[model samples]
Target chain A: EAEVAQSPRYKITEKSQAVAFWCDPISGHATLYWYRQILGQGPELLVQFQDESVVDDSQLPKDRFSAERLKGVDSTLKIQPAELGDSAMYLCASSLPDSTGELFFGEGSRLTVL
Target chain B: AQSVTQLDSQVPVFEEAPVELRCNYSSSVSVYLFWYVQYPNQGLQLLLKYLSGSTLVKGINGFEAEFNKSQTSFHLRKPSVHISDTAEYFCAVSDPYQGGKLIFGQGTELSVKP
Candidate 1:
C-alpha cells in the first residue's frame, strides 16, 4: 500500500537551535498539510498548501516556524530557535484535488527540545 | 468558524467489548467529518469519514460512525475491539469553504485491555 513518507523519525535539539522535518505525500495529491501534535492533545494545523501555493497559515507561528511545499509533492517544515514547547510530533498529510475531506498521514517526525 | 469537541479524553474497555467515542462540531458552512487513529510512536490514520452519504458510515477495522446533523455529532462505535486497538483517536472537521483546512478536536485515548 502506498503511504506518505517522513524522514528522521526522531529529532532532539537544544533550545535556540534549528530543526527541520520532511514529508513526501502520496503521488497525485494536490493538497498538503503540516500539523503539530502535543502530548495528550489532538493535532493542530500549522500550515496548508494547495500544490505549490499556500492556502492557510493562520495558526502557524511565523516568528519561529516555516513550511514550504516547493514542488507541491514533498514539503519541509522548519522551526528556528526552537523552544521547549516546540517539542511535539510533526505530522504531514495529503489529499487529492477532489478529496472529500479524506487525508492520508505519514508517520510523524518527533521532536524533543532540551 | 469551525470547531470540534471530543467528549471523552480517555476510554478504557476490555477485549471484545463495545465502545463509543463521541464527537461534536460547530460550523457556519457545510463541512465534512472524519475520525483518525494514531498508534504510539506513529502517525495518524484515517478511520472513516462522513461527506454527503448515508448518515451511518462504515469504515475500516469494523468501525462505524453516525452523522447527526441536527445534533452536529459524529460518534464512532465498534462492536468488538482487540488489544491492538489501543490508540489515540481524533475527531476532525474540514470546511471546503475554508480551503479544506482541517480543524481537530482534543483526542480520545482508547485503551483496549486484554
Candidate 2:
C-alpha cells in the first residue's frame, strides 16, 4: 500500500529557533493536512490544502506557523521562533478529491523546543 | 461548528478481552465521523468511518463502530484485543460542507495488558 512519507523523524531546537517539517502524500491525493499532536491529546488541525490552494487555516497560528503545498502533492510546515509549548508531534495527512473522509497519515516529525 | 468528545481518557483491559471506546459529537449540520489509531511513535491510521447509510460500519482489524444520530454518538467496539492493539484512539468529525477539515477529540489510550 502507498504511504505518506515524512522527513526528519525528530527535531530539537532552541526556543527562538526556526524549524521545518516535510511531508509527501500518497500519489493522486488532492487534499493535504497539517496537524499537531500533544503528548496526551489527539491531533489538532493546523492547516488544510486543496490542490495547492488553502481551504481552511482558521486554527493555524499564522503568526508563527505556515504551511504550503505548492504543487498539491507534497507539503512543508514551518514554525519560526519556536516556543516550549510548541513541542509536539506534527503529522501530515492526505486524501483523494472525492474522499469519503478517510485519511492517510505520515509517520510525523517529533519536535522538541528547549 | 463541530466538536468530538472521547469519554474515556484511558481504558485498561487484558488481552483477549472485549473493548469499547465511546465517542460523541455535536454538530448542527450534516457530518461524517471517523476513528483513527496511533501507535507509539507513529502517525494516525484510519480505523473506520461513517459517511452515510448504514449506522454500523465495520473497519480493518476486526473493529466496528455504530453511529447513532439521535444520540450523537459513534462508539467503537472490538470483540477481542491483543497486546499489539495497545495504542491511542481518536474520534474525529468533519462537516461535509466545510471542505473536510477534521475536529478531533482528546483521545483514548487503550492499554491491552498481557
Candidate 3:
C-alpha cells in the first residue's frame, strides 16, 4: 500500500532556533495537510493545500510558522524561532481530490524544543 | 463551523473485554465522520469512516462505529480488545463542502491492560 512519507522523524532544537519538517504524499493525491498533535490532545490542522494552492491556513500561526507545497506533491513546514510550546508531533496526510473525506497519514515528525 | 468532542479522555479495560469510545460532533452542514488510532510516537491510522450508506461501518482490527445522525454521534466499539490495542484514538469530522478539511476532537486514550 502506498503511504505518505515524512522526514526527520525526530528533531531537537533551542527555543530560538528554526526547525523544518518535510512530507511527501502518496502519488496521485491532490490534497495535502499538515497537523500538529500536542502531548495529550488530538491533531489540529495547521495548513491545507490543494494542488499548489493553499486551501485553508486560518489556524496557522503565520508570524512564526510557514508551509509550502511547491509542486503540489511534496510539502515543507517551517517554524522559525521555535518556542517551547511548539514541541509536538507534526503529521502529514493526503487524499484524493474527490475523496469521501478519507485521509492517509505519515509516520510523523516529532519536535522537541528546549 | 465544525467541532468534535470525545467524551472520555481515557478508558481502561482489561484484555478481551469489550470497549466503547464515545465521540460526538456539531456541524452546521453535512459532514463525514472518521475514527483513527495512533500508537505512541506515531501518526494516526484510519480505523473507519462514515460517508453514506449503512450507519454501521466496520473497520480494521474488528472495530466498528455507528453513525447516529439524530444524536450527532459516531461512537467506536470493539467486542474484544488486546494489549496491542492500547493507544490514543481520535474522532474527526470533515465538511465536504469546505474542501474536506478535517477537525479532530481532544482524543481518547485506550489502555488495554493485560
Best model per TM-score: 3
TM-score of chain A of each: 0.98, 0.98, 0.98
Q: List the residue pairs that clash in candidate 2.
A: none
Every model's DockQ? 0.75, 0.79, 0.79
Give the per-residue lDDT of model 3 (tens digit) for B33-103.
Answer: 99999998888998999998999999999999999999999999999999999999999999888777789
> Candidate 1, overall lDDT?
0.92
Cα error of candidate 3 at position B38, Å: 0.4
- List residue ranges in candidate 2 displaced over 4 A: none
- lDDT per residue for candidate 2 within A71-100, as digits (tens), equals 778899999989999999999999887776
Superposed on all Cα atoms, the candidates' RMSDs to the truth, in angstroms, are: 1.1, 1.0, 0.9
Instruction: Provide i-RMS per model in Å.
Output: 1.1, 1.0, 0.9
Instruction: Please tell me which predicted candidate would have the highest lDDT against the true structure.
Output: 3
Residue range B1-114, candidate 2, lDDT tens digits: 899999999999999999999999999998999999999999999999999999999999999999999999999999999999999999999889777778899999999999
- lDDT per model, in order? 0.92, 0.93, 0.94
Which residue pairs overlap in candidate 3's backbone? none
**Higher-scoring candidate on DockQ, 1 or 2:** 2
Proportion of true inter-chain contacts also present in candidate 1: 0.65
